[model samples]
Target: MIESISRRKLTVTQQLSASFLLVILIGSLLLSLPLMHNSNAPATTYLDHLFNTVSMVCVTGLSVVPVSQAYNGLGQLTAMLLMQIGGLGLVTLVSLSYYSLKQKMTLSDQSLLQSALSRSNSSGLRPYLFFIYKLTFCLEGVAALILMIDFIPRFGWGHGIFNSLFLAVSAFCNAGFDNFSTTSLTAYATNPIVNITVAFLIIAGGLGFANWLDLVRRFKAYWLEKPRHFKLAFQPLSIHTRLVLYTTATILLLGTVSGWLLELNNPGTLARLNPFQQGMVSFFQSVTMRTAGFATIDYQAANKSTNLLYMLQMIIGGAPGGTAGGIKVTVAALIFLLFKSELKGQKQVVFRNRSIPQALIRQTLTILIFFFLALLSGYFLLLITEPKLDSFSLLFEAISALATVGVSMDVTPNLSTAGRFIIMALMFFGRVGPITVLLSLLNKPEKNIRYAETDLTIA
Candidate 1:
């Protein structure tokens, strides 16, 4: 009986892990269709299809081919649909839609949803799932409508509307694929309407789904409903939300300032732009570094300091349960909390008046270890495959792709086939999650007897 139970558990875990990979495989096959391939270009290679598939499914914006020049409307739409599915998360979306259709959610379904959304098993899962679906679609619609202003005049009514919708979805999903590769939005870099609109959409998307819902619930109850004085009940923000907002703001401000200072004198990059343009580009770069992947300036031409700053931002990506990937803001915050507690000689890790479970702390450390290992392993592979590329640029590209941040230093397209494959695997692992993937592959331990306690000395 025990052996059978263990086997069933292992099987379930394996199936769960395979779900994301299977989706990526299917997406790649569909995108590789002749109609979806660039009409004016050569036949698509397996490597190209795989890389694009992972990038889209992961919602990471790194692409070897210029999106506008490479694929047709059908292809771009396919990519956008993949991004939408990825952004909302496969399991969460399926569960919410299932519930909306008046279907019952099974225990397994609830577990998957909770894991996907990073919610506690004891929390009210159904209502939260519904809120996530409703809030995400509503926000995407608003962002699309706002983006149409700049898109319509340029691309005309039909194409403009379509592009606007696509870009809005892309931005809000934190997928940085743009339709303006030929014209390259370089013309509108200074346009406040375009820049600010994109920035807002990106921020809204980067802020996790839970935070969006929490903000909405509180706003409606406090302001719109106008409850009795001294009876205003505000929903407290979760520790995840607090960490995400605080860390995101800190990274963005620091990244912007550092990018500006580093590139202000670089004649090839930011030197030619006026102060207003320079600042706008700097701010956009800062925002995009956190998994949005859009770039106003050529990342390759960016100085070493700017690239390093971006790598840091990519490593500490958006909040949990959001489309954006990385180690996650909460994980980073927990690490800091753990460190602070250690310094203060506290017994437990606490933040925002909430105590973090010890399991979560261990998980965070494991994630950090896996992340660094994946990054370093990918970098080393790249070094072997493409010896000509500079070490820093290669490392930046590896980390960006691994974090699914999509802020490449422009070495993506130039990578050899082997190098691209390595990145494709990294993107997939990063998106599906390091812990999930690792647990899926490992065997469950059998408990027979307790081991004798022992202590080891360490520095």
Candidate 2:
């Protein structure tokens, strides 16, 4: 298999998988340097450094130690840079640098972007990529300024500005990393400025990048056509954008309500807060639980129902082509639609008067199965590696890492060496995507001969 792969040119999937792995290894090396550690902090093994680097580059945020306790300022900046590279695709960044230099695209770079976006050609790829980069940095900058209002007043100029920028990047990358404290953002549970700013960054970054571009184009077209007549003209949104928006809104509303109700009477979690404050925290929890991974309340203190709900949300995650992970919102929505059509005894799956192609339905199921298997395999491995840990917490941690959600029931710090390795593997799989990784390794050729089809027994 190795010989065959070496002889053949690598496909786009293989290149992307290789690129991410390369970044992870390089990041681990950087984090292992002695200068990366705090002088007052205890010595760390290369294993710990690798683990931390993997967590940062994957944007999974499952650290064995609090970031502040582990590293100094330069170290934190390195980690932040890892999050940026991972959140923005490594290949995409390379393409961006080429654009900056006004260089013609290499065949490999053009092929990579085309495959990444599933576009037929590269005609509009340049403009689309530029828009995504500009939008991402602009949003992060705005969010950092907003957060400075809260952080600068408390930490003084230097620390405050750095903290604000770090958090803004972390939030917008949907990374759970916080230099604030070991508990993530618990200190600012009821602080409106922190909660709103962080939540906005997460949502904006999680919303599919293409969706934003689509919205902008539609807005421009509508305004340009306004002078044609007194009547207003609105462009129809793409089905992908419509589905993402609807699924996101529904999940947010349901998650907020479920969290609020689940923790209403639990003094350990949200019961101590006034009703208005509880609402604020509940909304933030809903926003972060779906793969953003920041925490306002102690998740372990909450009822079992809330944790269960969050795991489901984590599995659903954010949109495609976005910083967030998991199978993604569109995949979840398509699966639901697939089931609805099947239960209704309809031959075709339909959404918004548009009949879904069979190819898309199959692709959606394939993605779901890949993620499901990864989650289960990771959970079982964690069980074997850390038998002393609570089975429920182990399962929770597995889902968190595999979905790249990063929330835990305080299970991360106590993870055995083997357990930490397992979580790191899961985080990488979640970021690069299980299917993409698997496909990259296989050397099999397509079978042209077809066998006779037969129907299976129905349940």
Candidate 3:
């Protein structure tokens, strides 16, 4: 009976969603401990703790309190652990460990793993997961080392090491929580080592684990003195990879230029900095706006255009099946591709020389529709609950928190309890994903009788 139960089939989305929910519940309890509270043992409300816990576990850096000032060492460490687990993905870890332990992987387990990694049932999947683990550690270690150079000299070795590790995990996970204040990086805003290191780590992590796996395989094959069979052996990047890279590049470039153009005139923020520092700040903002929430400038003081640009960046966000969140880069790319294909009068939509599956297109559309609705609904609810807040800031906060982007207008802490709950739900749904949660709640669809094809035109 037990063996049969273990072998029973489950939808990949359902399993992943359930796993995330379980993690959230467990995390909430863990974070609510008195030890996790600050020195004053300030009256900790259950809902606040729950919201913060969910945010951390979702890898969304939105917080009701200033994280650096509110949490003690234990709480901070707990938050970091939650972010790492959430970023790595609960389902991916289970699947990796199952295979590593030489245990039999059930069909359900395999399906979940494939979904988590956004890969098909290819023979390379296992090796890909192993390589992902190795790649993540190596990249994170290098990022930590580079960041430590900036941190250690000013702060002592112990504090420096802690900050380095925290920042490394935070960057790789695309969680924007930073112990460093605006004042902290102000000194090193133009420091090449700090900017490049963090940027590299964020981009690498944002690229998604599947891309890392492909690059690793290609590099290993090339380095092993393998015969160069260009046409037969070379594996081109998949459609998902191409979409992510193109969209991310376009957004980053445009965001940086637009930010620079808009903010160069702001006397308090950008105008004070030298031209080089201004450019660096703009570039860093562009890179970090997507999902990594580290800010070199005070977001509250950013000009109107820059704020709007950052909000747009937060909405498009990073790639699928990775730590970063939002509607996802691929989803936005697909929408664009679909529009272009329609304009060209093409029957089928194609990306990277391959036809995108209709199911995927439908899924992407569903995600976008639900995501926008959720954001708007959350925003409206917040507006009603906290009527005193600025509408634009509230809207930005709602979308950012819901999408797990973590970019804020610096109003997170002032939100009411109801507002916090709404944001928490958004973070939870965003991290587990709309499609996954929808699938879990709805379960597998039953087959329907076939009907004659008919066309109905509207619009």
TM-score, candidate 2, is 0.93
lDDT of 2 at 446: 45
Q: Per-residue lDDT for 237-337 in model 3, tens only?
A: 55566677789899889888999999988986799889988888899988887777766777778887778888888888888756778888888889998
Highest TM-score, which number? Answer: 2
**Residue 422, candidate 2: how far off, in angstroms?**
0.7
Report the error of model 3 at residue 325, Å: 0.8
Model 3 scores what on Cα lDDT?
Answer: 0.76
Please give the lDDT score at residue 429 for candidate 1.
78
lDDT per residue for candidate 2 within 338-431, as digits (tens), equals 8999899999999998999886786687778888898889998998999999998888899889888888899998999899989999998898
At residue 262, give the lDDT of candidate 1. Answer: 91
